[model samples]
Target: QQQVKQSPQSLIVQKGGISIINCAYENTAFDYFPWYQQFPGKGPALLIAIRPDVSEKKEGRFTISFNKSAKQFSLHIMDSQPGDSATYFCAASWNTGNQFYFGTGTSLTVIP
Candidate 1:
């Protein structure tokens, strides 16, 4: 089990509203949970992350809530802004693996 699935394929949120996306994985061996944010023509950058040991992690306006038992996680963007509009991907990797498994991706647009 090495797949991570995310939804909703795309999203449009009003400015200052909250944007939420969900993801789930099939592999229990994955120890590193990372979310990446990518703008057009740019590589994904690590937005925030959490390990299986933690229930939640937050940085700035971004937060990650993880559920180890359900093999699921979610990203929440508080005070959504137009600048925050971009493609987001949920990913997972093991300590020993060189590759990271990514979700199909969610394109988020914040209306100004």
Candidate 2:
């Protein structure tokens, strides 16, 4: 079973709009949270990540909000563009991690 639950199996966002995806994790032992972006026929690439020590993290137009107490995290895409259309996944792992537990991905479509 998956430890993380991701919502909005698919999303459509107007160009320049904000695209948001949410995720919730079950295991408190999961200290490392990472968001990945995958293009078709390619491997998922690390987009952003956060530790329990940090409340939030942002890189460029992407931001991650983590609520450690709530065991939840979310991804926000600002000024979404057509090129940004892709599948997004949320994952969790421990400090001594070997495997990453992935959430059901969200397919995003940025309309031009």
- TM-score top scorer: 2
Tens-digit per-residue lDDT, 2-112, candidate 2: 789999899999999999999999998888999999999999999999988999899999999999888899999999999999999999999775589999999999999
lDDT of 1 by residue, 4-112 (tens): 9999999999999999999999989999989999999999999998899999999999999999999999999999999999999999999965589999999999999
Per-residue error (Å), model 1, residue 15: 0.4
- Local error of candidate 2 at 57, Å? 0.2
Worst 10 residues of 2 by lDDT: 91-100
Query: Per-prediction TM-score, please?
Result: 0.95, 0.97
lDDT of 2 at 99: 86
Minimum summed lDDT over a 10-residue window in model 1 is located at 92-101
TM-score between model 2 and native: 0.97
- Backbone clash pairs for candidate 1 read none
